[model samples]
Target: MRNLRQILLEEIPEFKAKGEAFLKGELGKMDFKKVSGGFGVYAHRDGKHFMIRLRILSGVLGKEQLVAICNLAERYAVPMIHLTTRQAIQFHKLSLDNICKVMEEGLEYNLYTRGAGGNYPRNVAMSPLAGLMKEEAFDVVPYAMAANAYFLQRINTYHLPRKLKVSFTSDKADGSQATVQDMGFVATLKDNKPYFKLYLGGGLGRNPRKGIPVDRLLPAEEALYALEAMVQFFTHEGDYEHHHKARVRYIADRMGDEAFVNCFWKYFETAKVKGGLDFSPEMPKYTKVGKTVEINHIAITSQKQEGLYSYYFHPLGGQLDYRLLRKISNLIEPMTDVHVRLSMGEGLYLVHLDGEEVQQVAEALDADNYLLGVEQTRSCIGVPICQMGILESQKALKAIVDYFKAKGNIKKSLPPIYISGCPNSCGVHQIAGIGLVGNKKKIDGVLTGIYDVYMKGKCTVGETHLGELIGEVQEDQLPGFLYDLASKIEATHQSFDQYMEANKEEVEQLLSK
Candidate 1:
């Protein structure tokens, strides 16, 4: 496996010269940089890829533009476009020669990919169902947009110990899953005005930990102030010695919650006294897809007025066809209040539709080779893509999904399961009900691909607890193996977690066998 730096040096011989020019402010073109967990591009390398993450107001884009963007990605980069976990798309591999043309196209579409990577503040992620969820107490989209606007063009907040992730949720539907972010704000109404329950330090990495609550409730006006205070604190007090320990979470953890909150409040009071912040604008509307042909995936016969009939489709490894996206956009356009919700699962949901539409949508998707379900269909960045990937998880996930379907024993109801390509666990497999981490195991003195089964935790971000591996199956045995595991879960009237916990020894023995 080649490090991104090595890959760049080998593939693009001028990489070092380009980087040197960039550093000297002499580079006429931009280039890429490899970071620990991910990769980034600097000022010179702004575009020239398959997909670019643009910082647009309200985080919205026109439908035709979106189609065009997808077409560009398919033509120049990868066939898939990823709307990142950070509210941006990763826009897979792009040829070095086409970067400038892609950037030019972005300008035409009112989109540009910058500040979506590096130590800078990432795109502000908000609940996809912000105002639409039945239980939402308030909408946080406005705050999210405000934050993005303030930080996007400005370089003041760019340099930090590590990347910052901010997420806001307006309801308990767990749309954005705030608890797993570096800075999180969940909305709750108080005295008729909306207040955000603030949390800090939650992150996923080698040392995964949930964020701690810093303030119970903060008026909307004070939210950005709180953000500034937190960032300031991180800049001044954060560890710079070890890169791994330099994240905001470490500072919060080292200072302790009480002290951190007290300091944050003090800064908030100072900012308020100085009259530096105000949030008088109405909450921004949910992100909209600009005008395009209407596409409808649901019909009245399949519509449901109540009871969890909707599912957000998180594509395995964040891969989606641009053409299919256009078709989906057309399918759902006629509905008055329909919105597409992007999930942390790296998938999107077509909400407020009935079962009929879902069936239609699913059928239409079949033509594109994208399946609909929440079974063993999960993935992480894999070989030739993510530098850290050891095995091909995207391919593995597809094979697993197909295998289960072909076995004729797949359950009507599926539990959450995730497959990770490597130990880095980018897929968040640790918290999954049934998780599989790809590894090479020696069988009959020959090394072969195998998936290690993990269980025993509520693996959704923030609420995650470490899971234990209970079994392993050869790559070829995964489908039948998973079927048996699912049966065990059903037979015991237990979630995958409970069954694994109860039969820990048995599971271990089975794996050893």
Candidate 2:
């Protein structure tokens, strides 16, 4: 990790110079992007401001890391720190003057931003409650953490077909989305020994695909071997010339299912012979780290640790108010073993706390968790910030929340709601609950915003499936349609999936109308 930090630090001067050239109009947009993506820096649509993503490995942000981020946010006058659906924090509206500084300072805490945006191995995601989930086969935090280190150390291996994403989930729920990553490891147990079922090449986006199993339970110790194999396989078989068909999923498609499996296995064997990647890290030690006032308003859940709990919160649309996070930092900074883990769904969990600590922290940073089922929506920072975005997805998320708040006591057992600005699935709209992809249509000459609706998708271990596209609805009509449907689901007293199963015709009628 120290080596990775030093490597990232050494590259800053060059990046700064290139950034300056771009600012001076000496670098074209595409040329600058080619240089900037590897550095995890992006200029705002205005071309004056910038934003940088800090990849928190396995979604763990220690107290030191959070405090450092807070200081930077304050130093930059950043009103909000955006949380991405992939478990990273982004500081928006940075200037070229401070963007490089932000990158350098982040390395002080060993938080690497390099390789975050490029066609490199992105953040290694994991179950936000990895060690804490009671149903997990075993704690996968250590292994996932090891893989993060392994990848960061070798990130200099450039020019993959596209960005590679890997994930580990401690249980079948696939909370970290192991079933939908380029290379996935879902923890399992055989005779009380921890193992992982490998899923390969599944991802969300324009041509979404569910990961294919390698047909065997991988020994937990050999997790890194599997990951390294993916790197090799992707490198060898990936289509370098075509941009759209470069992802690992495309390799699987081009090679055919059986051949893809066989080729990946051969690479896996080669990785094993090459050796040196043994992974058996000690589980993270949590010194029994609380009060009991009211952390249970909605966001609190118990950890596997007997008395310890984890508190959760979502700042609607994942735009965390810097002030709220600052307050939380102040509360947890002095405390031991308390840390934050950003969930893949734009929410976060405060772990290693007892009941007392939970209440203390919750009281200090007041928040209203979105109405559990139907109200909460995860969205990408679309339009202005994203070069690929087609809509203001965050504003759309806020609209959904505002609509529900205005309708008092509207109950729902709905699944997760995901909104993406476009078909790229940054908002993870392909799996689970209700999915919305922004679109536009010109009726006469007036262009109007609308959303392509998808429903009844699942992302659990054995049940992974893409969301079904039902129909398109005008953006303005979205809230009403959802509210009306949710009211009916509530009357049925069934979960969204269960209700949909029994009332498919009725649900489709509602959606169509």
Which candidate tops lDDT?
2
Over the stretch 1-513, how does candidate 2's per-residue lDDT look in tens digits?
Answer: 787778888989999999999989999888998889888888887888888999999899988889888888888788668888898999888888788888998888877888898799999999999999888889999998889988888776677888999999998889999899999999988999889999998999989999998787899999999888999899999999998899999998988878998899899999999999878778776668334434346677878777788878777788866777888888887767889999998888888888878777667655545536555788988887777788888888777767877887545566668999999999999995889999899856889888889987779999999998878888888888888888898888887878888987886787677
The residue-level lDDT of candidate 1 at 502 comes to 80
Q: How displaced is residue 139 in candidate 2, in Å?
A: 0.8
Q: Residues 17-54, candidate 1, lDDT per residue (tens digit)?
A: 45445445554432235321122333222333322354
On a 0 to 100 scale, what is the lDDT of residue 506 in model 1? Answer: 67
Estimate the TM-score for candidate 2.
Answer: 0.95
Global lDDT of each model?
Answer: 0.61, 0.85
Candidate 1 ranges with C-alpha deviation above 4 Å: 1-61, 74-77, 155-157, 284-317, 330-339, 350-376, 412-414, 438-453, 459-480
**Cα TM-score of candidate 1:** 0.78
Q: Write down the RMSD of candidate 2 (Cα, Å).
A: 2.0
RMSD of each: 7.3, 2.0
Clashes of 1: 19
